[model samples]
Target: MILAADLADDRGWKGPNSATPEVVELSELLNRAKIYPLHDRPENFRSPSSVSRKIGNLIGSHPSAPRNALRTSAGEVPIVNRFVDDRTPMKRQAADIRVRIRRGLL
Candidate 1:
């Protein structure tokens, strides 16, 4: 998981199952670009994994799941899941982020 603070510090992050570091970095940059404009103050953000399950539910419900995923057997894939393990593809981790308006466990 990559923390917002780490990206702010230019420390960057790479997932264990990430196929390419550049892709992860690019995604981080994109997310940061969107987030920084809305909440410039670091103090305004929540701590990692401190968000409500409702928000988590939203993330889990949205997004197309990984290709060839078992979840895709239903013809679609979920983007995130609070109950998924690290091995679960596309499972969002709570510690990886600390957005201003939302947070959640995984």
Candidate 2:
């Protein structure tokens, strides 16, 4: 949406030299916003555990597993990259993501 908005601006859609009113209205805005990963709401969140394997063991799925919580020098636990579940919440399930962007685990 940001990119589109920028593109619209660059294309003289919102300037003094604008041709007709090429205004992307709220309905069009809704349609455009649907294309991106929306952080504000749940799309297809996953179980906080079982983040690694499609078939998760208890250890792998447990949120407080020692392995899962192990911290790096940066003081952040590693993310489950290979089997990343889009279902995972941007908040609790991925503490590192929250910490990196929003400064703490909620």
Candidate 3:
């Protein structure tokens, strides 16, 4: 996930109008991205698994299952669960991110 995000950042988020303005505390980012995960079967939409396979494996899968993934087989993959765009509140996200930085998550 970090790698992919870095890739996205590297590529300037690809395509026109890709800027993730106000990524944190952004409703659209949270709504379109956040997920409640409960993975036991095949998923319907894309996830980090799909992202790694389809986008780039070096990006890596999100370490923890997303917050909104469900037990349903037809659940949307990246929706509500993966990092389509940034959603972590800037301040709250800092601590966790600092840990990641210390551990080289980026």
Clashes of 3: 13
**Which ranges in model 1 have alpha carbons more than 4 Å from their true place?**
1-39, 48-50, 53-56, 59-78, 81-87, 91-106
Task: Arrange candidates by TM-score, descending.
Answer: 3, 1, 2
Which portions of model 2 show Cα errors greater than 4 Å?
1-4, 12-21, 25-27, 31-106
Task: Please give the RMSD of candidate 2 to the true structure.
Answer: 19.9
Give all TM-scores, in the order shown.
Answer: 0.20, 0.16, 0.21
Residue 81 of model 2: what lDDT?
Answer: 23
Worst 10 residues of 3 by lDDT: 54-63
Candidate 3 C-alpha lDDT tens digits along 1-106: 3333443334434411223333222222222332433353345343433443322222222223334422223223342233444535322354454455456453
Better candidate by lDDT, 2 or 3: 3
Model 2, position 83, has a per-residue lDDT of 18
Highest TM-score: give the candidate number: 3
Positional deviation of 43 in candidate 3, in angstroms?
A: 33
Q: Is candidate 1 or candidate 3 better by TM-score?
A: 3
Whole-structure CA lDDT of model 3: 0.34
Expressed as tens digits, the lDDT of each residue in 12-60 for candidate 1 is: 2212222235335434333444455545635423322322222232323
